[model samples]
Target: MLQATLRFAQTAYASTKRLFSNLFFEDALGVETNRPVALKDLGLAHSDRVDYDPSPWLALRRILPRNEVGPDDVFADFGCGKGRVLVQAAGYPFRRLIGIELSPELHAVAGANLDRSLPPARRADVELVNKDVLDYAIPDDITVAYFYNPFAGAIFANVIDRLAASVRSRPRALRIIYVNPVEEAAVLAAGAKLTREVRGLRPGKNWSLRKSIRMYTLAPPPC
Candidate 1:
């Protein structure tokens, strides 16, 4: 009983920290983006597609440190719903920040959020693309790709294939940050080599909530 209480306390404390750290971003980060929609609801034929669930605000903070990013790098977020991650990443000094979303509804919300959340300084560097992530042509300059388990099975496979093709054509170093790596096996099959996989939450000693969220870094083989 005592162990369970301590674990609960740790989880609560960590959540509070996540909320406090995300305050610089304009939206209310503490609240979940509980908007729900299935693939069939979106008119997608894929039976394996997962529902929309925004990564917690603290996810970025925990994931970013594993890699060394700078102003020279261009970052793109796949399945960027509501543009929360895009806005948060813009606070960094990346060369450019892009978000690609398939759902017109979510894309519109993301656009509005970006308009309201991003300061004037980041406006020029940000681009919100309202299109299927698979259809969107990745820019050659884009070096980092962020994923929040946007899709799985076929859709996920196609995106990884495109990433591999992009690296083959451009011959540039690429970094992929995948949160909640459900399609990690597909990533490896597509020729990406896993660099790291780390938990997105802090673990409590006793009986903390099982954090299903994981941050992963994978890169295509060098050309």
Candidate 2:
């Protein structure tokens, strides 16, 4: 099913590109010509077809409040694509950072991007793994975890349950930061009660639209 969805998305993206070539070129104002590549050539699986907006990473910085984590803090990004969040997180004072990516191609891309940001000694502190988030086991060492609509509500629910169980087994205050929170209801349904929500994000230079982001720290469900 995941492969099939990726294939479908590949075809759709190609079709959309062809249909919008003028738009793409026009948006760039005739700077460069555009061409379509085969999806397999890009090494993305069907599940990798989903292009999630990376807004949540930026919004997350505001919601996590920076003060919540210390220099020894461990950070994790679920479904990290090309390592945007992982690379950006490296700029902060966190002692360790990890990004989980299901796409091998994306993992390599993110690794390369992260390599560019490293200060030699600190480069070893960041790692990106190519594995499904569902099958992936998060480390007990993580003090901060982030998500950006990596999957549907069902999977989000499972991840939420897993996070709660992880903390219960380990007993440390772990914070979950979600951006572009489309599966928020599912997170709640999984018994991961939200402790806070941050709204409104400044638009990037390319995008004229302003956006709102919500963050939720875990809390025990109301009995």
Candidate 3:
């Protein structure tokens, strides 16, 4: 009974928040981009799957300050669905913003959201790519990457390997902000050390039931 009631409350809260987000953010909002999509529907054979959910704007604001993200950072959002995070991220003065999404429908919506909602000057900073996350090359210049439980296991491992390789090829500061970190073990295995963990605003009142988010960075090479 308790679990069922919690679920109902969560659904109601999500609906109300979605309406508010669409109005204030000036973008289409929901777990379903065009239609409901499940993890299996994505069809990325090797990658363990997760569904899309927009990061709360307040939560994002809290995490960015903890990471010390600044104008010089080039930010990338993996599995950026409907570009809500990307759009919100534009509020910051990052050098550039990149979003990678595999679903064509979500990518199109993301592009449209950026085009329609963002001012021309801010829109210029965005690059929305429709490609498998694995195939999307991480440019050496990117210093910050954001993932909201984009994937786990193999897919997660592969992404970290690529990020590590990028750092090796062109050494620079990089930080990864991961929310709802279900595969934290994989992240730690790939050489990142946890720097911080935090919850969204109104912490004790978690209608969504998400776990505490964690920040990770590559451990300095052994002395």
RMSD per model, one decimal: 4.4, 9.5, 3.6
Q: lDDT of candidate 1?
A: 0.71
Best by TM-score: 3
The TM-score values for the models, in the order shown, are 0.76, 0.69, 0.82
Instruction: Report, for every candidate in turn, its global Cα lDDT versus the true structure.
Output: 0.71, 0.65, 0.75
Q: Can you write out model 3's per-residue Cα lDDT over 21-64, one digit (the tens) per residue?
A: 66655444332332335645665434475676667655567677
lDDT of 2 by residue, 60-140 (tens): 567766666798689998987766676557767898999997767667767776666566677798877888787898787
Two-way TM-score contest, 1 vs 2, winner: 1
lDDT of 1 by residue, 75-103 (tens): 89898877778877887779889998888
Off by over 4 Å in 2: 1-49, 201-211, 219-223
Question: Which portions of model 3 miss their true places by more than 4 Å?
Answer: 27-36, 39-47, 201-211, 219-223
Name model 1 segments beyond 4 Å from true.
1-45, 200-223
Best by lDDT: 3
Clashing pairs in 2: 6-46
In model 2, state the lDDT of residue 72.
Answer: 69
How far residue 167's Cα lies from its native spot in candidate 3, in Å, is 1.9
